[model samples]
Target chain A: MIEVEGLTKFYGAFPAIQELSFNARPGEIVGFLGPNGAGKTTTMRILAGYMPPTSGTARVAGFDVVDQSLEVRRRVGYLPETVPLYPEMSVFEYLTFMGSLRRVPELEDRVDEVLEQVAMLERSESYIGNLSKGLRQRVGLAQALLHKPEVLILDEPTIGLDPAQIIEVRRIIQELGRERTVLLSTHILPEAQQICGRVLIINRGKIVAEDSPGNLQAQLAGAERLVVAAGASCEQLLQLLGGLPGISSVRAGSRDGEVEVATVPGKDLRPLLARTIVEAGVDLMELRTSGLSLEEIFLQLTREENDEQAGG
Target chain B: MRNVWIIASREFRQYFISPIAYALATMLYLILGGIFFINVYFGLETGQITPDGRIVIGAMVTILLFATPAITMRLLADEYRMGTMELLLTAPVRDWELVVGKWLGAFGFMSVVLAVTWVYPLILHRMTSPGIDQGTLVAAYVGLLLMVAAMLAIGVFISALFRSPVAAFFVSLGVMLALWIVGSLASSSGTMGQLAGYLSFVDHYYNNFYLGVLDLGDAVYFLSLTALALFLGAQVVEARRWR
Candidate 1:
């Protein structure tokens, strides 16, 4: 439903995004994973028809974003990073105005439906200015979804919300993605993993890696570590964990009270690990699997990129 | 065109969202009512029966020259400052729709402001035996409407340059003041005098509509100014889409 080709955008001499090519089919949840200033916003804005890319083409719902911008805008729902809004308007009023601007039929009904979808039906009469940040963000999503567009381009959809709100927003996004082509950007690697079917990891205005989260995780870091914290001494905990089946390696140097236990992929060792610790009379404080952080993945990817450039 | 009306209605509602519209209209009523009462009282005392509108028009020219800038200063500047411009620009609406819609919205509000002062003429007509000439009254309101529309266009165009509405207001006020004084300031300066007279909005109003003459050239001047400013404002809006 969305396609971008050689989408290079330059702000004077600085290239914000360079030679980018990607597409999202209907019902696909594609995550744009990148850090700040990685051209995530630039790409999303171009796709949203906010601004034209300097030297590229983008199409939303088969309409060219540059030439058929209005059509693309009609078919694409865009949620900007800051959630631009008029402070004086009530949530219902704001959504109604946006619905009219989008030329949505049954505007009031559609507005109410979207408000309900974002779980903001009761606050619909409240002024947006008086709403909390999380509520305002929900209203922003409501406005974007007002027209029931075929494609949704959301930039950092869960950036500034509490954990519960983030989970709710993520659930809504995941549900929406089941029916529409959804492209969302995020700096949180775990967020991408949770919501995205596939992710395009962008760095320095380029796509460094693009694959499913599982594939990317396996390629980048095959082994997973379970950070086990206990009241017992590190030596005793490490000894207890060292004899566990399927444990590839065990170490205790990162912190005094924690022992890092490496295990094979595609296995949930948490239950086993927890049971053994309690049976051994070792007080288990915390036990959870730790995924590779974004920084670690970027470091390895860039090093490989540098090696490839040197080889060439 | 539908998009234009949609954008315009939104802008119109925005005026009432703040207290600015009511404030401006109330001030206009007080000032115009004071002038109308004084003029009528003197006429009744001196037994001059014929109703006059010249003094009211004179005062209005200066009042609108200042008042219009305030009404139009937030046309685009506030949207930029509040980030609402991003929403407008990203929607399916055209650039011209956004610009022209802003002008029409302000024009619509100014019309209400002008309408609120209609009681002055109504009172004058009641006080005078023959009453104010209906032709002159029609011409005066039409003139005010055109003049306000033109001024709003100029203000909207200038407002596109700044994100701060206060800055837009001051600059628009400066431009209007310059246009008002240009005719007299250059009266003795030869060719420049002739050019300034052509550019002077006060001269256009005072010589034509103020005299109760519905001159086509005068109407065209205001229309042309409005068209030129709207065209330029649309251009500025379109430029925002560029990287």
Candidate 2:
């Protein structure tokens, strides 16, 4: 568990994270969502005891981060954005060194265990510099897990990986969430949606929104979208859908020999529209009704935050 | 202490694998060899390279000035450049353990370099029929070793202050040169000056050990200086982590 109160960080005159406060309970995977320069890295560094907070305080497992840093460091495993590693060292050597730094009992055995867990046991002898980006990340994860700390703070853990590698890292992270506290920061919106139980959206060094994915979607409820494809011209489709009951607005696009129609808010007009389109002798290719995906929700949150700041 | 040993061993292992360790060692011994052979073969006419305490002492201290920075500069700079400092600083190991371990590792490297240079004296022995007096040779080697140990510590201390290897090298070299010069100048000035001269690494080697005397005061001076450097290195690292 962790507690943070009015945490602020200033790099000279510039504020990195300002008056930020949040708590993470045990066994929860909280996603830190933000755009670049949003202070996610700064916040994580403060929690990891790597950087001092400008004002306020953060506590990990009941110990003040600044006052009881050694204890806090012992309790948290931090993976920085760049995945710091010694190029000259083999994977096994790096993990062993990390284990000893944590003063882990049976360090060799612990190193093997983490290597196996990360699916890196076979590549233990490979020099870190020679490893591909994915394997290098795996090694970084292995080092963080070697100490078996209570909390894991990973910053952009899956950045720069291919799609498959991203999925692998995400699986490992989701597994890690079951038993340990996880605070993952990423700019990738869908990544947060898949693994995080709760989301904290930040912009301009401040927390703008915090909620579950479903709750966030529900907050913007009644914003239903309809994507339709018909044989009619785009303008004609837009005109017809635009005047329908319960429809807010309509836009027109075309692809694959069909006019693509976008209808705002209110739907189930699909059944009525199908009959009308058939009677009107217009071909219907596809019709679907859906709310915003998580990506849209994220952009909306950040855009709203930006708008509020600009308006003020 | 166990943690210190762990850190120290890892550092030593890294030095062995890296090119810097061999490069420094090779350069040191070659320079020492050149100075030793040149003084004996060429300086004999002018009595400049006589095997007296002064000539041997000068060679030892000069070798140290050339060699100490190579071992010490990379100690902290490489860690910063490689980003491994985060891994070390965030670990549970205390700041003192990290500092002392790294200092000892660089010191151990200096010892190995000195050990290799021993072959030079052996070569000199084989060349001469009766060979140089063993007692004076032993004293000269001891003085060189102690001076290097103290200078290596100073290098480690200065390295902790900067994340740049070039900067660390220049800063450490500047400090060592200033100290050595101060020690020599003090003796000619007055009584107080003479006392300062006694603290000079050059004076300690030339006046004491080079003369075939293993003075306890000289030995203690080097040991105390090593301790002071390592302590300051530890303090600098700790303060930086806090900031």
Candidate 3:
């Protein structure tokens, strides 16, 4: 539902984002994963029609973001990094004002629906200044969802929330992702992995990797490790496991009766190794696959990109 | 157009909800009331029952020179300070819509400020023996409204240039003072002096409208000045989108 091609934004002589391109499909929660100053906010602002890109183009729901900004704005909802709000206005008053500005039909009904969706219906009459940070963030979300746009662009939605509030906001985002295309940006690696269906790892204003969280974790590490516990001695199990066709290496695990077996890339040695262990008269207690965490994958990808740039 | 009205109404509502509007309105009425009472008292004591409103109009113009800045300082400056500009600019509304809406809001507030002083004319009508000229009074009030519109437009333009409302207030006050004093500063009769005299807002108001003269030239001058300032203010707002 969103397409950005050769999008470049420059502030004076310095480029904020250079030749960036990405897309978010319908009902897909695409996480823009990057560290601070990675140009994520710049890209989102361009997509939301807040500012035009210095060059190239971005289209949302098939409307040009620059030439057809009003149409693009009509079809997209944006929550800025700072969560822009008027503290003097109450929750319901703020939403009603935003609804009218967005030209939403039946604004009162839509306001109640959005307030309910964010679970903020009870505090609708309270002044925004009287609410906590988490509640204010919910009001921000309510405003974004008021018009029921096809696309939602959120920048650091869970930035300052406590752990529990983060989880709450994440749940709300996940629920919204089920019906609309959500393009959320965050420096928190776990947030991207936990909430986004697909992750776009952006570094230095460029996308270094893009895939599902599981796929990124598995593919970036190249080799898969397995922990096996059995009745046999460590030496005997190591010898037997190393001799298997696809087993690249075998070492004693940290546990008393466990062995760590490394498999070659794109190889499945579990069944063969199991059969060998069974025929050798060893009792197998446990066997499971071990994979790298998303944090490890992200750090490796960003570090590799940085090294490549430095070397080149 | 509907979007403009929506923004305007919201801004207008914001002004009324805050204490600043009430304070400013009360201060203005007291000042106008004091000037009206002193003028009426002195005129009646001198056996001239009809009180000419020129003195009150002169004082009103001088007071609005400072009051216009207070009313308009927060129009755009507060939006920047509070970071609401992001939400406002990112919406589907056009740049002109936001600018015109904000201008109308401040202008509407100034209307209320001007409306309360109508008691001055009413008192004059009731107490004066033969009564003041109704046509000239109406004409003078139109001139005052036009002057307020022009000054408020200039104040809005200045407000757009700064982020702090206090800074916007002081800078606009300085600009208005310069415009007010330009006529007196140019006492000689040369091309430069003539240009300065023509540019002076006080000269235009005192020489033409304060004496009950309804000159179309003066009307067009205030309107053109208002239009010019609003155009510049709109350009400033539009430039922000690019930066």
Candidate 4:
């Protein structure tokens, strides 16, 4: 439902996004995972027909964002990062105004439907300014869903909400994604892991990694580290485990009953190391594979990119 | 055009929802009324025969210098300041519609101001027994309406360049004053002065509309200026997508 090729946007000489290309299939929820200022907003704006990319092409629902921006806009629903809204306008009034701009037919009925969907029907008449941050965000989402566009490009949809509101918004997003193409940006790894079917990890405007959550971890983990708790002496434990095939290094932990094993990249030595350790007279207390957590992987990807830039 | 009306009506309603429209209308009525009262009072004391309502009508263009900025300063500035410009631009509406719709809304408010000022002439006719020629009122209204339309267009154009409504208001007032004064400045010079005088908004109003003559040239001047201003405003809105 969304296609992009070489999409780059430059604010004067500074390139916000450079030669970036990605796509979201119909009815797929693709998480745009990145930290703040990772060009997520810029890319979403271009896709939503809010702005034209300096170079390259983006199409929404098969309409070119630049050449057929109005058409693309008609088919896309976008919620910006800040959720900028007219505070003086009531929730219903704001939605009606936006729906009318799209020339949506039977506008009031549609407005009510979306308001209910976002769980804001009761407060539809309240002034947007008087509503709390969570309610205002719901109203913002209501406006985006007012016209029932086929594709949703939400930039930080769950931002600035309390914990409960965040879960409610995510549940709503997960439901919405079941029938529409969703490209949502967020810095929260768990948010992406919980809801996004596929994750596109972006850093500094480039797609550093893109895969399913489980697949992404396996790809980045490369080599597995094993933590072993055993009855052997620290030096003896290290020496016993050191000569095993594919064993790169072995280090003793702070306690006498703990040791850690490192292996060659792309190899899982857990089974072989376990068999070797069990055969030996050393009584093993515990043994488990230690893979990098999602948080660590996220940091490592962004941090690695930063280091590469600094080193250059 | 449908989109333009949708946007325009929302803006017009916004004026009433806020206190700006009521305040502006009250201020215009009080200032114009005061000018009329002083004209009659001073004329009676100085032994001047005529307390012309036409002069009071002419003075409106000046008051609108401040009034136009107030009406227009927030039209575009608030959009940028509050970040609603992204919402408006992302909709299916075109750039020209956004600019023209806003200018039309401001013009609608100014028209009501023009209509209310008709009471001044009505008062004059009642007191002086057909004091100012009624036919002249039509020509005067035409001139003032056209001039208001042009000034509002200029104000809309200026508002687009700013995110600060206060800055837009002051700059708009300054630009209107400079344009209003350029005609008097023309008295000092020669050929260029004639051209400069043509740029003055008052000259276009004072020579034709203020005198009760609905000259086609002056009407064209205001119309063309209105078109030019709205065109520039549309261009500014369009430029944002590129920038």
lDDT values of the candidates?
Answer: 0.86, 0.81, 0.87, 0.88
Q: In candidate 2, which residue ranges exceed 4 Å CA deviation? A: A228-285, A307-312, B35-57, B119-143, B188-199, B212-220
Winning model by TM-score: 4
Residue-by-residue lDDT tens digits, candidate 3, B181-214: 8888667788888888888887788787777788
Give the CA lDDT, 0 to 100, for residue B29 in model 1: 76
lDDT of 1 by residue, A1-312 (tens): 888899999999999999999989999999998778889999999999889999878888999999999999899888999899888999988998888888889988888888889889999999999999999899999888888889999989898899999999999999999999999999887898889998998876889998888778777777888999988888988888899898999999577869888899778899999999999987888998887765578667766766885899
- Among residues 3 or more apart in sequence or in different chains, the pairs in candidate 3 whose N, CA or C atoms overlap within 3 Å are none
In TM-score terms, candidate 2 sits at 0.87
True contacts kept of each: 0.83, 0.74, 0.76, 0.87
Rank by DockQ (best first): 4, 3, 1, 2
Residue pairs clashing, model 2: B186-B193
Candidate 4 C-alpha lDDT tens digits along A25-106: 9889999998888898999999999899999999889999999999999999889888999999999999999999998899
Candidate 3 docks at the CAPRI level of: medium
- Native contact fraction (fnat) of model 2: 0.74
Q: Give stretches of model 1 more than 4 Å off.
A: A222-295, A298-312, B45-50
The TM-score-based order of candidates, best leading, equals: 4, 3, 1, 2
Better of 1 and 3 by DockQ: 3
A84-105 per-residue lDDT for model 3 (tens digits): 8999999999999999998889
